[model samples]
Target: MKNAKSMSRHRVAIIAGLLLLPGFAFAQQSITVTSWGGAIAAAQQKAMQDPFTAKTGIKVIPEDYDGGLAEIQSQVKTGNVKWDVVNVEAFDALKGCDEGLFEKIGFSKLPPGDDGVPASKDFAKGLMSECGVPTDLYANVLAYDKAKFGANGPKTINDFFDLGKYPGKRALRKAPGVALEWALMADGVAPADLYKTLATPAGLDRAFKKLDTIKPQLVWWTAGAQPPQLLASGEVVMTSVYNGRIYDANVKDKRNFAIVWDGQVQIPEGWVVLKNGKKTAAALDFVRFATGTQPLAAQANIIPYAPPRTSALNNVTGATKSSLPNAGQSGRAVVSNAEFWSDNGDDINKRFSAWLAK
Candidate 1:
């Protein structure tokens, strides 16, 4: 009788555990997603997150953070991760994964970018990573006030550095990422050898030397919005601006701005899940949903940053949205090399900073 009672109790416990396993997914009714603030967040809310809730009944709590992994590192160290999923730059996603602070993604689970192509084949090169899903695409492109130059605007990256020809104060974002790439390209560095050459000290010096040629004419901008505002007010003539900012300026604000897609450096933002978060499973589901073809395309309508999915691009309408940075970007687009930047960015930024101080 004792043996039978013990066996019966074990069976009851197993049944209870089995029942709870199915309920576990539905237990968390909400998840917090962190992203860059302003228009990007608004678009995600309308296009992705809201639709996700309506379909899965999982509430999405949206939050904003400046791009970096320091806070995430702290969260993981303290075992108190508040963000289920974070939208990070390519290098951040790469570095965070290398450090094991983020969960290693299972790329096989992601839906195809197009029906005929696998997920791995669909994304533009360097967009996919072991730890993150590529979300939206953007470019560091030059935009000029159409009122100022109109027909004779600086048309190429080479033209941007040609101070004697298109003489004026030009603005660049205060970072070594795209600016250095542009510097090398403007100095006749072939697009294919950008990172290979940048690996050498001679190449680094060459980029800085190219930058030095226009130091006096440079207006350094830290924020994305500053370039367009500065351009409208005549503070800078042609500014290195995000394509979306230029899109907003022309379509929404009625500012006379035109983007020079030539020599544009494309950067893809990623969505990452932190390790050991309670909501990790749900977060993965949300990322899978948010990065789908239609959802990504919907985001393009709200903001001009291209969708990473090739199928998503098919859903985008209008000439403005159609021309977003992509794989076939007219031979002038350089996809940012996340691995190289992850390896060398800190040291490069230090050198770039010292040069700026001097």
Candidate 2:
């Protein structure tokens, strides 16, 4: 009887020892994620990092890359990729995927879908995969000072070109995506036909010719934050500006800026997993957690950005309602075609740069 009892105890000890082997222990290491540094990073730390660390007992280290894409490209070329997870712009993600700098996502391990967010997926999923999961969906809307436009506000993109009718200092992004689209729209090309026309020589010429009309009125802006400042200081009465900046100026500062959603050019931010990451599984797990409905909604609420998950949108509370784009409007707002931007972004940017220089 004594010998049999001793043998049972010895077997249990051996099993426990095997479970604590070096290989198994090493699998629990923490992961590092890289992302664009700014206000978004603060929101991520609050919504994702703290909660994930508490739940999993794994440390999450967040690093910022000021020039995110350039850093990633440098890492890839040098063959010393340090990023395990990254937040990339939609266009950058597409470019990275094409270059094989990203790993294929595995969707089977993610949480169940809530509202519009996919149930499972990890790798290069946008913040909100449905409604085009936008990390940040900012409209390059026509923002005008209520004081300037007053009772006769510019209602559409057409008004942007009618400077003769509503004259004031005007600003526009010096970049191509929205600027080109706006230029073509001002040329009387329909939104649906804008891209197609730009693809043809005549359409390109037409857009350039139309732009020439307003060129003198234009104050070219390079950064997203510049336009709102231009408006708030009364340097410009009307300009194409990011919706968030306009909202902040209007709501927080009590400025009279307003956004015209018609023909708004939406830009989406995206996320991706790095290729050859050391903690691939853990990094994917983080992605799933960060993009989960509650976390996504929470971040959106705090940051004035849209949650990517459909379920996340449902979780958005009353406090967040006032800040979201088209919050009071009927039906879902129009989102920019990420695939289109991803495909033509480089060529457009180059052309726009040349035009700006001219």
Candidate 3:
């Protein structure tokens, strides 16, 4: 369960081709960076993308897309990959690398972070990978309207399922990613045993059964911007959201939203070079600059997600760090398993899709 005070998280999704890294001429050549087109992308632009361009005198173009693999796969398959660098979810990064859709990045190319921690050692566990370099450490958290629930709001993941007590419509992402894990968690699965339980047919059925309880009252969102809007307009009293969206709303918009980090599922997003792109050199350079200690840390100051590099935490404002999903006071948190999702996602995706169709 998540409160409305702060929200930041990314889920696994998306892909694309590689080419030679071309030289940049300050105002001439540019590499298009693709990411979700919400506050998430805005924060990245403010913290990394724009600054990177300013610092290197390289032009950077931003683009948006729903978190899907079809586009990227098509680009790579057709050998017309347009994106020099792609920001993808962790599981997609793993799947892409496994399918040879991404360039195999090695640790040697990554320099030590500003804090002096080696890139290989600096990133949080499960972040350093073969294809993608971890860029953001986020948590899919629950946020609620304070006025609706008053002082006694839904405080735990279990409470999200207790419709009788909460008495309101709920919002969650339409995809299967963390929705299944949350269902199992609310049904009493321990954090440590979540994947193991979900791996079993009985466990899978149990999760779906739990989700069935909230099906009629559920409102699903397809974009990161929708969750906060749902709560703001009171269409849904409570909704699952990225930690940064709620954080920005609470800080900038002055909304009475609370974020409950309990049962928050942590996810790390990464930037990868498309093997079919023409700018392998420039793409790798951008990835390194963006994921470096200073840039990664700077991104957190503008948003609520924790930085992947431990060193970057030092740069985040106290207010931001305190509300992170992994903070000690934020309650129990679990990292999403990239390998499990990468391997079984296709099958589970179909099942989730079928259930939604029904």
What tens digits encode model 2's per-residue C-alpha lDDT throughout 1-358? Answer: 9999999999999978976885444345677876554456766778887888777756878888643366777776777878777876666666677777776653554675554445643222443332112345545678888887687898878788887787877888766667778877766677677767877878777787888888888898765567778987888878987676776566567887877777676666755777766777777777778767777777777666666556776777846566666465322134555666667777767776787788
Best by TM-score: 3
Residue 214, candidate 2: how far off, in angstroms?
Answer: 2.0
Q: Highest lDDT, which number?
A: 1
Q: Pairing residues by index, what is the TM-score of model 1?
A: 0.86
lDDT value, residue 276 of candidate 3: 81
lDDT (C-alpha, whole model) for all candidates: 0.85, 0.69, 0.83
Report clash pairs, candidate 2. 113-119, 115-311, 116-310, 116-311, 117-310, 128-133, 128-308
Error of 3 at 329 (Å): 3.3
Ranking by TM-score: 3, 1, 2
- For model 1, state the Cα shift of residue 307 in Å: 2.3
Error of 2 at 334 (Å): 5.1
Tens digits of per-residue lDDT for model 3, 17-82: 112223334344578889887777888898889988887766788988877677888888899988
Write down the TM-score for model 3. 0.91
Clashes of 1: 0
The runs of at least 3 residues in candidate 3 whose Cα sits more than 4 Å from the true structure, single-residue gaps closed, are 1-27
lDDT winner between candidates 1 and 2? 1
